[model samples]
Target: MTSPLPFLVVQTALYNRLKNDATLSSLATGVYDFVPETALYPYIHIGEAIDTPDNSHDRYGGQTVATLHVWDQYKGFKRVLQIGSRVQALLDHQPLTITGLTHIVTRYEFGQPLTDPEPPGDIRHLVLRYRIVTEQTP
Candidate 1:
């Protein structure tokens, strides 16, 4: 009866490194420890079943959509642009992991309109879209 947004849990340390390094060129360049087996959390949702007859009862199944949000330390220049490009490339090749998932960059945007002036420092906002299959653990 409840629907939750799909999410990926990455190490805070790894995230911090990526956040701090203003010049990180690629995800491959960052050092991240492999996630533990118990850390995988797959989301679930209820929707219409694909193969059940319309007149039959209990014709509903579960669906899941996984996504992740990566916030990088703002590098007050072209760092946003650079990081976005690198992430896009990774998604195109499905290189984020070795199994059970496919990732694609569905959208990318920048700039803040609500705040009068952006904060000072090397920081940037990044939004990444990905699709994951939960049949196998990654």
Candidate 2:
């Protein structure tokens, strides 16, 4: 049997978790893989992912490192930081329901804050990352 794509599964699970959370829904406009050009000021965007194999003699496993971006047009980092904290609280060392795979653990890797230096420099960006480890069933 062919093993499932760990990165895609992990990403989907993460998206579902964030999208359905009432707290996140109230904080951000929406969770999106592709953000609309006219999307509102605050939103969560599922960004890049990296998958690496972690196979054993008897089981197939993988590690997926994913990045989530929080964008806001607030005056300072307060808004974005609050949202990022919620994201971390939701996923850090938490359990994820990955389809067709056994979830080992999902750990928060790091968070970075950035500024969009374009014309109006009021845009705030927070980059959050997580590492998800999964293994296939026997």
Candidate 3:
């Protein structure tokens, strides 16, 4: 049988956690892997992910770095920042239920705020990243 991918497992766990979070749901419209064309403003999206092998003598392991984007049509960075903070609280150093892998730890990498310069300049974007370490379940 093929081994489960750590990147996909961690990303799926993150998506499910954020989607089911009551506080986050109150702040953002939705958490999505694929944002709809008509998706409303103020939403969270699961972005790019990169995985690196971290195997031991007799076991398989990996480090997965994932990016999450918070988008808002607000005039200032306050709204996006608030939502980003909530996300950080949920994931940083928290336990994740990744399928077929033993989750080691999740660290909050960084969060950056930027303004979208295209056309309507009122869009605020917050880019958040997390590093998750995992090992294959024996």
Candidate 4:
């Protein structure tokens, strides 16, 4: 089975790029922008999962659930960015929906730390969870 960590990394990178890319911002009409660390402190929870068949008949399968946490100073902006049209493009046309969002799952703040001792400012962090369906072949 393929590791979900790699997919998570790729997904996170894509989100960061989309949030920072000027062209996407222009096209999306500034729907996304730099987010702050504090705003994301509450943290947003995203859920995803995948199912894979175990038998040759393809009747039975196992499911894998993915969870994500997002943090940004601009909570509203970050949420909007996550559900923006750009995500559809990033998925290469795959259907991904922002089903729901829960703030402050835990008391942990996720994001890149600042070079100085001071806390990272305006840094948005997100944790996303997803499920993927895989077909088993004999």
TM-score of each: 0.34, 0.95, 0.96, 0.31
Q: Which digits, one per residue and each the tens of the lDDT, describe model 1 over residues 1-138? A: 222222332122124434344444333233233433442211111111112111213322222332333334434424544554655443332423322222222222222212113555333434443332222222
Give the clashing pairs for model 2: none
- CA lDDT scores, all candidates in order: 0.31, 0.90, 0.92, 0.36
Top model by lDDT, which number? 3
Q: What is the lDDT of residue 12 in candidate 1?
A: 29
Q: Per-residue lDDT for 1-138 in model 2, tens only?
A: 656678777888999999989998899999999999989979999999999888887888999999999999998899999999989988998888888899898888889999999978888999999989999976
Error of 4 at 83 (Å): 6.7
lDDT of 2: 0.90
The residue pairs that clash in candidate 3, if any, are none
Which lDDT value does model 4 have at 113? 22
Ranking, TM-score, top scorer first: 3, 2, 1, 4
| Candidate 3 wrong stretches, greater than 4 Å | 1-3
Question: On lDDT, who's better, 1 or 3?
Answer: 3
Candidate 3 accuracy as lDDT: 0.92
- Per residue, candidate 3 scores C-alpha lDDT tens digits across 1-138 of 344577777888999889999999999999999999999989999999999888878888899999999999988999999999999999999999999999999999999999999987888999999999998999
Instruction: List model 4 lDDT by residue over 1-138, tens digit each.
Output: 422223343334334544555645553332223434433233333434333333334333333343444444553354434533343344332433221211111111122222222465455544444443322222
Error of 1 at 2 (Å): 19
Ranking by lDDT: 3, 2, 4, 1
